[model samples]
Target: MTADARPSLAALSAPLVARLIDDAPALRLGIERVGGARVVDAGIRHPGGLEAGRRIAELCMGGLGRATLGAVPGTAAWPFGVTVHSAQPVLACLASQYAGWSLSHGDFFALGSGPGRALARQEALFDELGYTNAADNAAFVLEVDKPPPAELVAHIASTCAIAPDNLTLVLTPTQSLAGTVQVVARVLEVALHKVHALGFPLDRVVDGIGMAPLPPPGGGFLTAMGRTNDAILYGGTVQLHVTGPDVEAEELANRLPSSASRDHGRPFAEVFAAVKGDFYAIDSMLFSPARVTVTALDSGHSFHAGTLAPELVERSFTHVP
Candidate 1:
């Protein structure tokens, strides 16, 4: 698609939101009219179902593709999986899925991700991607235990240059089922971010697909956080189709997995504790899928990296033998 013909993320996702509201009102994923803004609560007040989680994951992709619930090939404790596919992988994953914004107001804070980030244009990554979008409406996904307040919603509206009524926010806490699914759904985003961090030209990436085990929910925040992180760090895998030089594709493939980091080979929870809960203190390269494959569309050559650490995944997931 040409630059001018590409649809705004919000525009592309609005229909999906409407479908959710209409099809599964019982899921309680609806538009909240607060302070003249609309907030879509996926997990906060209501118990967001697996289907809602799937839709929220798709929303995170800016509706560029789909995220479906399934199972990994050979896993027991972490059998559930979220499979993602997108034609515009760079635009859908990096431009929309990577949670790059830290939003806070008073005591409320959440890492904002989704179509709303494009509308806000608050990160330099957008500039580097040569992408900017504007829409009368905006949408955001927030990983938070509580719903955002009216003031925070208004602040987001102002940043997006949209009226409060034109904004939509989706909330999910790390400990919730929906939250776990959505985070695991970020397998592709994690791999793409790793490639970008390695200085790979993202424009060469034509398509992407990823899958990571969906962790069972019920633990407190930190435990749940660890399991989700381990789902990607130990069990996730991604395959990216790229139209780039074969050498560059090989380099990206080598560097695209979590094992490339010094921080690899441990449960992410242990690493988090070792860093004293300071996320920045840990190696940034640790946040990636367990395995990655880069296919050079031009040369018909493929490069693979890393290996799935199912032992670590079992260790982190449960105590059962």
Candidate 2:
């Protein structure tokens, strides 16, 4: 399909953003205005919880996907889990939810995600996908402990060619309940990202489903970030449906899981600290789900790889003191 034929991601996600604002009180989200731009505080000063995270996860996908929280058997203390699926997996996961845009001002830095990115097209990924969009309004999700500065907000609006009043930003801290859920909710996005990095044809990706055990929010930022990343690296699972030859599907499955990286086995925080927090020093292949299944649609066969490291998951989630 041609890029021009695609739906406007900003337009698709507008209603979800509006609904989040309208239901801010019930969701325990703080609705505030920053320099004429609307800010939805999912964790900062408010006690945003699971439901809010679920909704925010969908918003992160630009309304092109569904995120549901549930409990599966055999999870022990961490029984709760998050499942996400998208029919437009490529566009929803990579185009909108990938957290690929970098935004910074002074001491504050954030990677911007959600439908608003489709409008800005700031990253080269957009060009590779041959996708561009326009909208009167834009919505973004920033994994931040506080709202962005006015200058950064203004720059975002100008870049998207939208008014500040038409802009909405959602703030989520990694140590908060809402923040943990939303970040762990990126299980499917993590898979798609790995697939892209593997040089698989994005157009062949038809559908995807991903689930990960949700850990309790950690006591500090480092612990929280570790839990989130470990949730995917050790406890996450993904199944992708694609149109391709069986051999290609098998190859993709073999190469797609977190275990494919030499940096696997250890908790992500340890890995980060080992590299002195230089994310670039770590293996790029380490950012995938624990287990993966890729189904070749035309041939009706599925290939699987990797294993769930519940031992590591338990150690990571419970040992933080």
Question: Against the true structure, whose lDDT is highest?
Answer: 2
How do the residues 129-181 of candidate 1 rate in per-residue lDDT, one tens digit apiece?
87889888888888888878888888899999999988878888888888888
Alpha-carbon shift of residue 92 in model 2 (angstroms): 0.5
Residue 32 C-alpha lDDT in model 1: 67
Q: TM-scores of the models, in the given order?
A: 0.95, 0.98
Best by TM-score: 2
The digit string of per-residue lDDT tens for model 2 on 183-262 reads 99999999999999999999999999999999999999999999999999999999999998999999999999999999
